[model samples]
Target: MNNVDEDNALVNFEDDQADDLDTSLAVDRFRDAVLYGTDWTVRTLLQQIEQGNIDLSPDFQRRDAWSLRNKSRFIESVALQLPIPQIVLAERKEQRGTYIVLDGKQRLLTLAQFAGDFPDDHPLWDESRKVASLRLSGLRVLTDLNGKTYNDFTSLPDLAQMRTQFDNHTIRSALIRNWPDEDYLYEVFIRLNTGSVRLSPQELRQAMKPGPFTAFLSIKSAESVTIQKILGLSAPDFRMRDVDLLLRLIAFSTRLSVYRGNLKQFLDETHEFYNANWGVEQKGMEGLLKRLEDGLIFLCAAFGNERHVGRRYKGDNFESPLNRAVLDVQIASALDENVRRAVEEGRLDLLGTFQKMSINDQEFAQAVAGTTKSITAIRTRYNSWRAALEGVIGQPVQMPELPNG
Candidate 1:
């Protein structure tokens, strides 16, 4: 395929929703044990923020995802004594005294930023960085407080009275006490974190889920210098895209054939299975990571800098997404005796063999780079590539068809 075709294919599965749920899959039902904590004043929460009793997992929460308007609107809601959403906290099992935010982080963060020196991102945050001079924007019902900061009161009595009211404003809170494990917490977070806007799959996974697998992914993603370079990503991706990519790798490498149409659903399914069987699957998961590294080494040896990965094309648009889709399939299908042995020995003459397969095998290209989610595309590519790879390496091997996408 030409660059134009590759470009089109680069968008493979951009908005692809997996086929409907598989009926045979098990249903997960859970009821969490939660402590409905007593009502809290705004002063109490602000004090907690100052004392660092509330721990916002910096890895997950550092993105300034909320806009300034979002901050202003929320602040106005609190200022007007509106009934705000209850704050949700997961009492950290390890950190005996601290809490990790499970929901309403934006609310807490907005309040903290508002009360302190004005964050330049805020609407009232002028060049001087003073929040005391703040003004409310888009205040509908509380128009009297508009264009006035806490320090803008002309009368001392009025200022003290308003300050007392603001400080005494109540914030209801719920505590997820005594979570059995990180897995349960993660599930709860996923269930509640969705508001009008949804959280990303990876973000949901990391929020409260504690497990060997997710923990390992977090550690590996942060330390994966080589993996990041191979996949053409910046190391220590704060947004956790690399971690998301890792999940996709694990999902596709192990579960490609059974892939229902929806990527998120497939991932959620994978998450449930892994969390349930992590003790048994941990060794195998490690092996998959090793094989992935081997696969990347093989690809770089075979394709050099033209990895067909990354967002921007060196000679093509970012095929990182496409490259991942293809690579996962290839690794999972590497059951052929010859291919397996080559990978085991670390001496696969990948460049010569890949070139020959590309030249002599037209179907190979189509299968590798066609419509990404078609069953035909999934089945034909793996089978054809296996055949071509084996032929160039000299073997006729039998392998199962790749599962549905």
Candidate 2:
């Protein structure tokens, strides 16, 4: 959502004004005022940035394209570790109070942009900033859980001077009784975000929700932990969408198959799945999963293949009959001994048997139908079989552990 036009007030400060104003004391006093509503200080914001958890949403910063030079500036600031720019916020008198961002989008974005562990060679890297911005580069500021602690700022301890300066550096919010038009806000978001590091549509969605499911995944194709770990998550990886799919796969496979609709529906249903009989079923599945893991390790030992299979399947390993059928099935099965028996008795042959298994479930059927269009029908059918086998094993494994709250 855009809100540029909705923000009816704007404050323009020239470098001269900033240079002349003794803002330290005023900043200190205004700290309390700012804290009352936003409750964020330079310390807290920086801490979140270092933690790579700041909310760079429409409410915080606009979506925009960021050039390498812009990224370098951000990296320079991080390397210098300077205090993040002060944000001026105001409250709106709507149904519930809403906070408005008054200034500091560029500086705030610089913090949010480079906060993540971007590759070392990228222009935005902290090390690069150090090498490039030699003078300001060496100065590193300390960050707290609330705001930034600057040696330069704190060095000036004149209380009266600081107080007077803070008063002079006035930052306030303006609210409206009637809500601004949605189009105005949208335009604001776009205009502010244009020509900067713009957020994607999916990223925007994640910001709106900002919950467990939403919080779980929010990276671009350039960086997908799921692709790195999960078997078969390929390039052009659908970052959040992939995570959403995985969660759904796990949820549906666990017996919430009836409720697997959109990501939102599955997330809501997950809570109920935990409370229902499936909880016990999932536990059984987990125990079986452990057994299967042990069994796979044993199989690896038997096969003399000692390499680690990361948490999820990926690439050729994902499509491997050995992984998709035997490993996946055995892992999901609740009956360890039964699985062992099956493997010993050629039950592991289920990898090939996947082709023979009937597709009766609606969810699986639809998946097969949809996937077959892109991949071969045979491959889709096999994948469905793989999921079913894994699902069966998963149900009997110890309760499908809900993510730790």
Candidate 3:
């Protein structure tokens, strides 16, 4: 987190696995999308953004991660009349003529910030609520423009022509107006964003499905000290990987009965459902998060940090990076009142039992590694962990019955 090297060392559980099962269907679905290209001058685009015709979703606003230097360089490129990449936009189905940004968010935001006209409510703003003006720096070609801001150009007669050139610079944009549904639009967004800096699926989902539930996930993930410690993160992940793991916990713990093997679809459905019904479901979701936190804290106290959610197989010297499947079942089982009481009352040696199982259980080991998103793997890990806990607790530990598929 604070140390760049240590932060880079944290492992992602699903890095090797495919997010979704079917790709041919997605390709077939997108074939019908109606897309057209247009060029918009910087002046016109800024006007649209100011008039609220262009929608920068809350998630996109949160991910304005470019530094001031980066923004200034981009402005320098515009000043030099360098070619810029095209942006992609999808028309909002609910509000005609208004469009949501699917790509080039940083570019657009940089333009607004450099022009000293970015919205004050935008997440990029500091606590002072003042619009940040970008001063050009690190310009190789336009070296004389360094330290100059848009306001400086307005005030200085010599810089007036340079400001006009920047305003008249046109950037190409591909607009999709007739998408069948949000799903198709999300696919388009994902495809458009496959550049040098690729977005994680959860990041895309956050942008596409912004609502109370998504906000809850982000806030809770950031606030949870236990989760941050377990994951070895000093701060919230830039790509929202921490949020992705928390979503897995919430989905499996609350909606296991409806899971049908596809982790991506299941998580997406959970987001959509909770977002749509957050008014009534907020309290229940809050309870779930509290239970998860309690479970995590108990595990840390009992087993210490290294072995909290890390996986170790037979003959292994060190624990593997935090395993999503292991975390899911362990935390879910710990949420049971009986299991917690048994462990706290000294009737059960939870750590010893877990270590024995980790060293000897093949089914459990396989379920936590390799391909873990399938129905068989999920059920195996949950049921196996529940059985292990039940044997130690001397009582039945309740778990949701997953689908047979």
Number of backbone-clashing residue pairs for each candidate, in the order shown = 8, 53, 0
Q: What digit string (tens of lDDT, one per residue) describes model 1 on residues 1-405?
A: 011122332232322222212123223323445566768888788777666577544454333345555666777777668898899887777776578777777677667655643335543232224323335566677676666665553345656666676678899898877766545655565567444332344765665465667767777666665555654444444345567767877777677667755555677778777877999998988887876766655555445553443222222233444344455544553434567676457556554555555556666555555345556666765676676666655666544445654
How far is 94's C-alpha from truth in model 3 (Å)?
Answer: 2.8
**Each prediction's whole-model lDDT (CA):** 0.58, 0.35, 0.74
| Residues 151-190, model 2: lDDT tens digits | 2234456434432332233222222223333223223333
lDDT by residue (91-164, candidate 3, tens digit) is 87788888777778778877877773656765444422453466778788888888898999899999989999
RMSD of each candidate? 10.4, 16.9, 3.8
Q: Which numbered prediction scores highest in TM-score against the true structure?
A: 3
Instruction: Sort the candidates on lDDT, descending order.
Output: 3, 1, 2
Once model 2 is optimally superposed onto the true structure by TM-score, how far is the C-alpha of residue 4 displaced, in angstroms?
34
Q: Candidate 1 clashing pairs?
A: 18-261, 18-262, 19-261, 182-210, 257-403, 310-320, 311-318, 313-316
